[model samples]
Target: MRKWGLTLLAVFLTIILTACNQNDSKDEDKKETSEKTSQKKEASQDESGEGFKALKEKELNSQRNKKTTNDSSDNQIIDYTDKQKIAMLLFQPGLDDKFITADDVLKGEYQSKFSDGVKKKHLPKLTVTSLPENTQMDNTPTGTKFYNIQPFPSQYSVNIAMNEHNMIIFGSQSPIPDYNELLHGLDGMAKVYKTKDVIKSEKDNPKLKEVEDKVDMQ
Candidate 1:
């Protein structure tokens, strides 16, 4: 009877120990699963945030390109050949002055003042001849006299000329941020030609004397 009791007590203790170990293992597995879920949620949030940022950037760029395209189209339709004569004058008055250098002229304050002055003048028969260095005169009207007034100290100057029919288009440039604006301004000043006007002018003023004089000189 005593041996049987001891055997039963040892069996009960062994069963209790095994159950405790299995419970511990289940608890550990639950903890590992929860940790993995939390990490996945964090990674998903990060990816979503990055995607939103990329979308916003793409939208901004699209708007910018659209604006640029519209402006370019408007400039392209401008008529620069309508006028018989056109003149452009650009004066950077203090550009080469002792107190102001080319670098100083590029400042915002100076540019504003210069641009405002040109706009206010609004000369009908003048053109601003301060084109970019890379500008080519291939399409420019014949007999146009482009002068760099202050050729040495400043890159700005005036263009004066008569077109084939003696009609005049005067243009000027201010410190405009957009090149399209300047081109449009020039196009505005050019006069549209009519077939009748050309025929009438030629009939009224024949070039016989002019042709004879040129022939003699040659």
Candidate 2:
């Protein structure tokens, strides 16, 4: 009877030790998985921070190295390409009497007009009036032309290309705050598609000449 009791005691001890070992193994595995997940999250955040820093440095360098050009002609013509037009429109003075800087656009301070379901202040709401009768602008896209005569003494028009389906127009009361910042922001946002400046001389737009003549007379 005594020998049988000793053997049963040993079997019970073995069972308890085996169960404890299994539990310890499971706990170790869970801890390792949690640690790996934490490490991955930290790495991702670090990469994002580095990328943002690099981009800001590149933009600053570009601004510092930008060149200035002077046109000797006295044409007094204001012309821009499709890409420039878009950038100028985007960076025009805002409600705060400031431009949407490249940093703002890059940092997601303002959403683009192309953003979906955006009812907020995504685009500038300019006051629009009809163009002068019988005045033709050569660069005017094949659509409607409306004169924006606010916030500036000189009147300009924005053409909406409905027929071509390549452009959309909205008016702004203010002009571009900084051309360099405009180009920088547009480039940062990957918004510039074309770089050539499309010139629209007063000779091409006879109405412009008429308006200038009237202004000079006044």
Candidate 3:
């Protein structure tokens, strides 16, 4: 009887140990699953936050651009420290025959780039303002926001227009960030073109002459 009792005691001990081991394995699996789920949630939240931040930044840029457009005085500062070259092109009415490449200037390759950011349905015109003066809309006829200089891609133009029967183009080899400054320039140049004093005038600055010389040489 004593031997039988000892055997039963050993069997009971083995059963308890097996049960404990099984329960421990299940607990470990649950803990691991909980940790994995937590990590996934953290990663998801991080991605969502970053997406929101990017969207907000894009909105801010659009709003600031509009504000710059609405207020002519809010001129964009030029980063000339980077050595941006200022250039312009002017086409006179009677003095010169209409530019032979005028069609190319208004359509093809250049016009395609201007439509990049906008949808096909909302094809907005490229904004042009006189640099330094940003007076494109000042003292001009109503209902006209400077002449749409075509095919001359705004990405390349920096400032451009076909105002008062004159083609005025302005740019910097280095991009001007606050294009409104160039808008001011567009306004000033358009104002000057009205007088038809693009060349050989006391008001013609050195840079303006250089641009004129470039087109004449071309």
Strongest candidate by TM-score: 3
Assess candidate 2 and give its lDDT. Answer: 0.38
Q: For candidate 2, write residues 1-218 as lDDT tens digits.
A: 99999999999999999999999999999999999999988878766888667888898877665532224121212343332333333332331222333233333344333325322243222223334422332343344233332222112222222111222333333443433333244223212212122122122433332222211110
- Model 3 TM: 0.27
Q: 2 or 3: which has the higher lDDT?
A: 3
Better of 1 and 3 by lDDT: 3
lDDT of 3 by residue, 120-186 (tens): 2222222223333334333433322222232243344333433323334443344434434444563
Name the candidate, 2 or 3, with the larger TM-score value: 3
Please state the error at residue 175 of candidate 3 in Å. 34
TM-score of each: 0.26, 0.26, 0.27
Q: Who wins the lDDT comparison?
A: 3
- Write model 1 residue lDDT over 135-162, tens digit each, in one string: 3444444443332222121223222333
Question: Which runs in model 1 stand beyond 4 Å of their true positions?
Answer: 1-11, 34-147, 151-218
Candidate 1 achieves a global lDDT of 0.38
